[model samples]
Target: LFICIDHVGLAVPDLDEAVKFHTEVLGWRELHREVNEEQGVAEAMMGTGDQLAENARIQLIAPLNEDSTIAKFLAKNGQGIQQMAYRVADLDHVSAVLRERGMRLLYPEARRGTSGSRINFVHPKDARGVLLELVELPKEAEEH
Candidate 1:
């Protein structure tokens, strides 16, 4: 079952600039940052509230390579919101449900995401033109 809106993924042309904008201008805290070579993107998580709290946050993602999905997104649509992520209690069950409902999953299986969460995306066409993500966070990361 779905827990909550985990984070909003934003595609940006420049990762460093986006991080600087959020941290320096908006005064949001940079919770974490990392480069996911497998995904070919560099990402940083920024939030306004408590770091340990389960709150909606922004995930700034930029292309790490020309062939990355972020690069293609920037090329086709410029920089903007890319995906809305929902945290799930059981990713496998959720995936099965989606498949049973005939929804198209972008990935055949869950893949490693930021902060070591298992993540998968639903095809945008099946989600009313907006890409949707399902994330299963590590046990230790869950709120009490």
Candidate 2:
């Protein structure tokens, strides 16, 4: 159903500060960064050693506005671990299987995610109170 743990997402009040702390203090290297307006968040993918390795990711996500989900999560739980992402070979297939198994996904269809990956979320309520993100990397990236 899943390849590996893709990344662990951390909700932060400030993206720059989070990235700086992770990079400078934690000795992580910044791998990728992007802003997804539709998701209303700014994110950075941090890593060490081989950037593309499955074990090398820690995503830092910051709300773009007060209305963003990250903002709401921060308001309720404070800045912390927001989600655990799993890599999938086929998002649509995995989504269908999870649906058949009675897991509720947040999106009816896969949505655009960091680094051109197709992604969807398993509802926190259905995922044992943990937000779970499913990601299918782009074809070119799959070979890496």
Candidate 3:
């Protein structure tokens, strides 16, 4: 049901500031930037621009509204590890298993996520106080 670690989500107060810091200090290149309106947040993926894909991903996220969860987290805890997303082969199977085990889900159903993959987030309570995001890509979506 689960594949591998997709990416680590880091909440940031300001996306541009974080982006500039990472680009200038760490020398990472910006791979993509996107605003997930449904999720009420914006994000940027930074990487080394080399052959290694997984080694250089740093996702910076900022909230779109003051009332948003990200905004609340930033206000209370400051910018830090927001969640960890894992790539999965079968979202339904994973969700069903998690439900059977009494795990709480942040999203009742899978929704659109970055890179065109379907995603669902598990509650922090069930994920050892860390939000867990599960991502699954359709076969057709993976081909391209």
Q: How many backbone clashes does candidate 2 have?
A: 0
Ranking by lDDT: 2, 1, 3
Give the winner by TM-score: 1 or 3. 1
User: Number of the top candidate by lDDT?
Assistant: 2
lDDT of 3: 0.84
What order do candidates take by TM-score, descending?
2, 1, 3
lDDT of 3 by residue, 1-144 (tens): 577787789999999999999899989888889999888889997877643234547688999998778899999899999998888888978998998899988778889887677889899987889899998865674544
Pick the winner on lDDT between candidates 1 and 2.
2
Mark the regions of model 3 whose C-alpha exceeds 4 Å error after superposition.
50-55, 138-141
**TM-score for each prediction?**
0.94, 0.97, 0.88
Q: Candidate 2 vs. truth: CA RMSD? A: 1.0
Which residue segments of model 2 deviate by more than 4 Å?
Answer: none
Cα lDDT, all candidates: 0.90, 0.94, 0.84
Tens digits of per-residue lDDT for model 2 on 83-113? 9999999999999999999999999999999
> Which whole-number lDDT from 0 to 100 does residue 79 have in model 1?
98
